[model samples]
Target: MYDSFRRDGVWPEFDRVDRQLLRAAKVDVAQVAAQIPPDLMATDGPRGVPPRGHDRMRLTVAGIACCEGGREDLDLFFHALRWMAQHEARHYPEPGKTSVKVTRAMLAKALRIPARDAVRLRRLSVLLRDERWGSVGSWRSTDDQDWSVNVGRDVRYFRRVRSTDDFIAATTAWLEPVTVATPAADLPGAASPQSPAEHGSYVDERVFDLVRQSDGARWDCTKLLALLRELDDNYRAGNAYAAHALLRAVMDHIPPLFGETTFAPVANNHPWGKTDGRYMKRLVHFRDQADDVMHRQISRTPCVLTMEDMPARAAVNRFLLGCVSKLA
Candidate 1:
């Protein structure tokens, strides 16, 4: 039924929406959606099935903007969902159909809610699973206490359909290309790459907390924070040269955590897994690019490097996570 919702872009069954969880007198998602302007709602075309046989409506990108703006909980819940999706790819016990294992504790940690307030996870999950809202898969509870949810492969709904201004700004500022590779449309099951702003937000928040808690040299923590902030600023400003130089600075500064003085030895000698090692090699290559950006003399020809030369967000996060682990 949830799968049908994904395919048809309408709730397959209105009976599924828990009225008690929604805390509304009437369990009418369609009524709420009708209140929104038709321009903001999903098109009543082929995919947008009519609200028949207890089916409810799905919102458009603009509709989501209006609804989420008023509902902070909905916005933050989606943040946790995105974070869970990333974590599903990152962590061990590689996920299958049901990926994220969401216990009250885990959800609380993800949302930074106190344990006492953790009951809200149930309500949050209900709202997110609603077709008129997040439009994700159904929640399957494990052990009657924790829920396992899948991010799923069909992510058309996950794709950011935004205002023209927001789209242009995001593309110009946040699109840090890891390479001049083939477009995603040419690759099978390939989604667009994560933007720097998307992944960096988590790193920034986690590292800030780590810095506050760290017993390491205060100077080192301050320096690390400053470098990370500047790298992010350069990315947003589309200053690829400054971003490259700052990435190198980060590489040069954090080797002590891996029981090494320089990044080369850390890459070569650290007993991390092959995946992490691959990222380390990529960073090493990025370091070389940074050197060129900082020291290369003006040439007769144009410089070939652009923002496309920036390292992958995952690799950068892996590098910083290593530092974070050691600091924590």
Candidate 2:
């Protein structure tokens, strides 16, 4: 990406003053001075020295985006993916055939994300393979030795940019993670998670802290933490049945926090927002679905449940908050 801008005479560089200011702000001026294509950084003179001429010392736009894009790793990864599509993708006669074959080694080189980061790679690969998110048509399993994805039809436009502005416009679709619209009952503002694991994220961060700090003085939240962690993992892995079972476990486990033995009383009697109350009713419906999943035998026509059968994160989180507030 930087090379493209450099060739167009639009590479953003720092002047002597800019470097000085960055240094004053405790930025790693020396590190910033290093050039990419690794070979240049190694063969180039001492790190952090601007070239003799002022014209040759511009900061790359890639550097600016990395520092300011909020999610540095993801932003850099997105750029790498875009760069690969634009410059390296192979085109075929059919739609959605513009694709790039990538190995972990290739990704590590392009995005600076280490090939050994299996958890991160797994998370990212799940998103990339999802049609609703990355719009990928197919990919080898993350466990595959040479994992890669076939970019969907959208990549055709993703690579057709005539100028820098066009490139920006083309790739802006990735600026925010895409989510499939749920029913209006979910309350649009309630369950907005920015992470790739789109479901079971409503188990609050404070719950984790509470579990970590668990002692005899109050309650043991370790079981809750385990279930919540599994819930999140199953949801991200698209294991809908396990996720539903774990969610049911979560609802069963937390009732004690409300001084009740079961979730039914809390759902039926707890004070929550009017809309949240409506959603909680949906959660009650979900409990029946959970029963169907747990007790029903497979007949000639089995009743299979999916992620859609789970209640919205909003309802679950609201119920959780009610219990947590009791702790205060």
Candidate 3:
């Protein structure tokens, strides 16, 4: 029976031992018989359907019995358990002694039908714990709940099984690191250095660090990095026109720190006037070059911006880092 559930093989004999094990786990025998079809449980009968649609079905006698005496919502408790079973069947195929541990994030990933929210996942976990369906653990009060079960040994007997350790490792690999979002009002000054090179290096380090620590902040930082690298590569390869166009694209997308204020005033105005003003002027020049390259009526030129435009690139990098730093 264990092997059958773990591997989806033929049904096992529903013998006295199996019944005793279910009884020990506080599972209601009558409920199990009613929820699981007789054909599916029979060893000599024709092949029966899988338990995939059990989620849609109303709580069966077995399901209610499995809920250790707690008043947990039958629908959610069953749904969480079904998700755990499905994950075990698909990811951890080998039979093992250790039970499977499940987390809210794991449930969210598995049941992607409509995408469950954090609140729903939390509620489900609470219900499962209250019902004695599974045990919950956390290192600290503020930490997220972690759930584990001895599927066929602890709360209930099941045909399917998997290792708890393997499940944790797999889930950790799949889930993204959680991060807090930051608002635009918290953004710092876009230009903060005297030397363009120093400013560029500072921005690069901050943006890279943020990318490594945050999942939500990754997209924009990654895009900025890709464009910057391409711009640098094209400039070095003497594809000056391509580099100029990429720089413009980077500037357009790097979420401005100054809200709706135009880039022109920010470049020529105070606060940025010291060193950033000079670089901004160069960036404006490159923008014009990009415009000319895109809209020239005749004599379309190539490789207009050269290594001499490195300062403009530095300026843009600083601006991008300033914007990205606002992300928590």
Q: lDDT winner between 2 and 3, please give it.
A: 2
Number of the top lDDT candidate: 1
Provide the overall lDDT of each model, using Cα atoms, as 2-decimal numbers.
Answer: 0.58, 0.56, 0.46
Per-residue lDDT tens digits for candidate 1, residues 130-189, read 433222366666642466555542222233323433433433443345556667679898
> What is the lDDT, from 0 to 100, of the residue 115 in candidate 3?
45
Ranking by TM-score: 1, 2, 3
Better of 1 and 2 by TM-score: 1
The collision pairs in model 2 are 12-59, 13-58, 13-59, 14-58, 14-59
| Root-mean-square deviation of every model | 10.0, 19.4, 18.4
User: Please, what are the lDDT tens digits per residue for candidate 2 over residues 1-328?
Assistant: 2332323323324454346556778665445555454322221234545433243343222333444332443444456546445434333435545444555566656666676665455434433443122344556754634567645445534433343344456657655577786654677555434223445454644454444445334776667778888887777766777878988888888877777897777777888769878877887778888888777887899565667667777777776666556654
Error of 3 at 168 (Å): 35
Model 1 spans with C-alpha error above 4 angstroms: 1-72, 75-79, 82-90, 93-98, 103-122, 131-137, 141-148, 152-240, 258-289, 297-325
lDDT of 2 at 196: 36
What tens-digit string does per-residue lDDT give for candidate 3 at 177-291?
A: 7556444347564422222322212124334444434436534356656776676556556554575677677666643544434556545553554566676777767667777
Candidate 1 global CA lDDT score: 0.58
